[model samples]
Target: MSVVTNDEVRRELVEFLDQRQPDVVREWSLLRTFAEQRTVDAVGGCTELLNSLRRAARDGQEQNPAAAGFDDVRPMLRASAGGGASRRLDLLSLKEPLLRLWWEHRAGTPAVTDGALALSSAVDALRMVQLEEELTAGTETISMQRQQLTELSTPVIKLWDGVLAVPLIGTLDSTRSQSATESLLEQVVVQQAKVAILDITGVPTVDTMVAQHLLKTTMAARLMGVECVLSGIRPQIAQTMVQLGIDLGDLVTKASLADALSYALQKTGLAVVSADQG
Candidate 1:
């Protein structure tokens, strides 16, 4: 195969693009309708890509020009990913008009053929870069969502002036357990509460591991000068804990939230008296 000089390739590409300017404009106009909500202006993007291709041919090195063009297009590609547009289809659609023009201007010439191959290689490089950008964007989105879920799963609610309660729901894995403990301890310091309640009414079962998690949380709260109360112990859970020989040591336990709250209020030197009693 014969190699074509950079100058020859640049000349052929320039001529092809100049002759097909109107057709390229029409293609972009049509594509703009599909990308209306996207930040990437289709017509401007097409022009930029063409200019990059021209520079690559002119310099005989595709990386610099191609990379710059891809950088310009990266944000647009990320926007498209969020908006349900197919990146591969967009690339193919953009390439069609230019490829058609190239084929028509210098179909049978060996030098122009090599030039066409180089142009195709540049387009493929742009695609690879776009894919990488999309992957990074996706990973970032997942990390944010995970953080939000953690916050939601371990909500610390203020029950009174000097009491905070954390209601645990669903499974109690090591990760969730740790998060709940940290959140409770932080709220203890922030609210200056003397009492912290861990309610497990929504918990379906109690096992050795679950008991251990509760013990650890109680120990942590004690270290912060706050007493911890465990509530929502159903009959089944109590039976399970007893059968499993899970000793909760000195931790206070209550059968219900109301009982726990009543105890907390008493510890804080506040009493709820009925009008009839008075």
Candidate 2:
């Protein structure tokens, strides 16, 4: 039910930091080393944070000094999160030294309660900012990983001249299907491929949706003047396709990639024959 003036809190905080400078430096040095080992960049490390704290305390009369402190370390926090460091551990390492210094220095002061309360608010603000940064960083990381996975899942390899192959593995979700279609289409243009092979041997199952995705991809390749061949038709998938009434309607399907490749080579006016056969 009591109010603490910014000026009063700032004075107390400055004194606290100044008095415990030695301890602060020593603790901060250890934290800096830890951050460097983890991040290799000291831009938003302990030293920068200490500078921010000092600036925030000096600018106590500002609207939100704690927020100012958080801004300084925001970039560092994001880097830590992006690097997949333990957020809780990083926070503990950063906050413990400052909190210990405050606790030791705030004892027996005239406005001890008010100073403690103000410091607590500042600490809480920093924690909240850290959480937000971590969340943003985590979301960005997940998005990047998802894109990498998509690329991995739908790998379009240049099997031979004028021929490209996309080996699809796993369940064909809408997103993955879209990605595959785009990647194959792009490769068709880039490679000037006359033939594109879609091998789904690693695919676990094929439903109507999977069938539609294949149709769409082949259609796209056709528009680009490239013949798309669907390979890796196991018995179970063929049966499912028939039962689901998924009409692949004259889009060339092959039993295996080797067979498809052979067909493609033949179309390109090439042939593979054994020396003994010759």
Candidate 3:
């Protein structure tokens, strides 16, 4: 019997796929492994995928499969058809047809066995790429969402003609503090306000770090030509500040947002009294 090498088997498998492209595509499209029913062009995507597999089969090895093959086609795999992070299940559906090709030659010539191994390696490499893409995309989305939440949580609202207010409602972390300060300063300059209020009624706790963030925000507002009124300093929080020797250092403060708003209205020469007062 003539000895057949691994390379010969791989070449034959590649040729088989090349010759049967249409049939393979049709068969792959009908597999039940696909979980996501996408609107992708099935024929075109399957054709491109097969083309990658052929290149992979030509250059890839069963020992180390993730090195090449699909590297050049990463953009299409990441953004189109079944290659996106969201369509990983759909990508998994592709493995069924490739596995069947291996089954077809499992009991045939030794060359067929070698070809099947190469085909299996190429498919495994694509799986690795898909996992990496999904992880990267998931991390990026989380980072973007955190940034948006930080900005949206510290909304600066106009309370009066010359007054703006920032109502803080969560932990005073460094990121949120910086977001608050930047927002408050910008609005102070844009609204040309004389008074700004930092209301912390919803703040759950007070610590040295929280005190420092509050002071920094007030100082920044001062530089923008707006006086800051710290409000909603609950009794427990005030006691903690004193216990910790945290100083207000001549910064104006009030017991509640209502008191702070009253101070703001007076500073802006506006009065809100009941009609019964007259």
lDDT of 1 at 248: 92
Q: Which candidate is the best by TM-score?
A: 3
Enumerate residue pairs that collide in model 2. Answer: none
User: Which order, best to worst by lDDT?
Assistant: 3, 2, 1
**Weakest 10 consecutive residues, lDDT, candidate 2?**
35-44
Write one digit per residue (lDDT tens) for candidate 2, span 1-278. 55657677778777776777667756765674364453423432555666656666666622253356558678876776666654333543556677767777776666676666565555565566678888888888889999999988998899999999999999998899999999998888889999999999999999988998889999988999999899999999999889988899999999999999999999899998999999
lDDT of 1 by residue, 132-208 (tens): 76777788889889878877888999999998999999888787789999899888889999999999998999899
Residue 221 in candidate 3 has what lDDT?
Answer: 85
- Residue 207 miss distance in model 3 (angstroms): 1.1
lDDT tens digits by residue: candidate 3, 1-278: 87877767777877777777777777776665332444265555666777777777766443343556666656555564334545544565676677675566345666666666666667777767766756666687789999999999999999888899999998989999999999988887789999999999999988989989999999988888888999999999999889999998998999999999999999888878999996
